[model samples]
Target: MITYIEELTDQEREAIREAIQLLYRQTYLLERRYDRRTEKYQYTKEYRTCSTHLEFLKDYFAVAGISLEENVHDGIIYIQGETLWGEKLPRLATVYLLILKLIYDEQMAQAASSTRIVATAGEINQKAGAFRVIKSIPSPTEMRRTIALLKKYQIVEPLDILEELNENTRMIIYPTVNLVLSGDHIRELLESFSEEENSGEETAIQNTIEDLSE
Candidate 1:
């Protein structure tokens, strides 16, 4: 039996437990292997090793039906797939959902363990097979055009995905999830905008952003 007595966040501990519960049967039990040569009791969980944990996350996304791709601009993980809400989710929104669900919420915020990653184009290509086959993966040029259109029109306000970085940095970070017209609250927001807003720029921008991003 491998034992690891360490300070873990509630979520972190739960993730490990889940990994053990879910993956142990297919994979081996995650042993806290002791290096007899060094005589040190390892504190980290071990199942199988890979070049990057993101590779494992790549598999994880596959289990969830979101195809992850690489972005040339920032080299972070990109997603192309259907939305969890049944509406078509854009690559940005898909990625945001995966990050929110699997990585940030389940793995980071909930799980105590830290599995670090920085996404790349090559790995994304290997992992994003489904999206590519489905023609959902957008080219780099398309991504740029969509972002620019969104900014110009005001369909969605860009939140700082990379808060500390200057605007010159191409790192785009913001909630990609937008309220569609069918949403009640979104209708209210649109009504409010129509009443007070002088610029039709917002409407034009929103539609263009959705068209291009999707």
Candidate 2:
């Protein structure tokens, strides 16, 4: 690996280093991320860097028992492993994630071309109320913090200032939502909520966040 890297140009080496650090921080890197300022998707340089050094990255992450994978069809690159470092999401964040996954699925089913989906803060609250996932709507401060956390990990991107988030504020739900929880897991959790509702009980969704980091 050293010999191969030594043969690369200085710029390539620096890019590879940056790519490594980026993966460590975010776990997943999309080839194209939504740019609110441009109102379009733009190619990510880190993704290109990772693609250029795929083999080296695979070998490097292997030492830590993390498996680096790329989905060309979806333009996503991610790492997964039991040894991965992760964050313990707050209950509200976990609930929001579940709602986002549902929204993504619903949008994808109706989408004709683009996979990029958009949703509003009001819509999220509506879903939460419909599902009875939480007893009441989250305060603006709670919503801001939750969105910021998910944005940091590339799960969602705000279309407006987070501080001013309200029912009408918009956000771009990234495809990375699919990686956060499998379809089966999502169904299971939703079913559990349904059963609890039927039984006149409340249940909180439990997530270890083992697959998400930083």
Candidate 3:
């Protein structure tokens, strides 16, 4: 990896460095992403850079005890490792994530033609309530923080100004959500929720912001 980087032009080397930083910060790089400004999907330069130098990037992350995995079919590249300590999300944020994953799954199951799945905050809250995940809707402040957190992790992107966010506010749920929580994990969580409801015992859901440094 070092020799490969050394052989690159200065500009190329800089691009690689920037791409590495982006991956470290966002955890995932998609070949294409939703462009809020245009309301369309567009190819990502960072993803192209990463793809062009996959071997070097893998070696670069591997040295830090991180493993980089890519899904060509999904056009996603994400990193994972025990060394990547993640922030524990607040209960409300965790609930929102679960709801978003469920929404994504349902939409994909319908054979939606677009890779980008759009949903509204109202739908998220409704599903949370319908699934009995929360006793009441989260406060705007909590919702704002949750959205910001999810946005930072590249899980969801708000379509409108964040300050104006409300039940009707729409957002794009990124495919990265699938990598974060697998189908089996979602089923396990739902089953746990069911058990909690039956026992009437509040259990803290274990959810962490992945592929991030502490």
Q: TM-scores of the models, in the given order?
A: 0.23, 0.83, 0.80
List the candidate numbers ranked by TM-score, top first: 2, 3, 1
Candidate 1 per-residue lDDT, tens place, 13-84, comes to 566455434332222122232333464434333222211233554565577676544433222233334533
Weakest 10 consecutive residues of candidate 3 by summed lDDT: 205-214
Native-structure RMSD, model 3: 5.0
Q: Per-residue lDDT for 78-180 in model 3, tens only?
A: 8887666445566676667777888898899897475668899999988878777777788888888989888877788888877998899999998878866
Provide the lDDT at 195 for model 3.
20
- Model 1 regions more than 4 Å off: 1-51, 84-208, 211-214
Collision count of model 3: 0
Cα lDDT tens digits for candidate 2, 114-203: 666889999998887777767788899999998998887788889998877789999999888777765545545653553234233222
Q: Looking at candidate 1, what is the lDDT of residue 45?
A: 38
Clashing pairs in 3: none
Candidates sorted by lDDT, best first: 2, 3, 1
Candidate 1 clash pair list: 11-110, 11-111, 12-110, 12-111, 12-112, 153-205, 155-206, 161-173
Q: In angstroms, how far off is 203's CA in candidate 1? A: 10
- Model 3 segments more than 4 A misplaced: 112-115, 185-188, 191-214
Steric clash pairs (candidate 2) = none
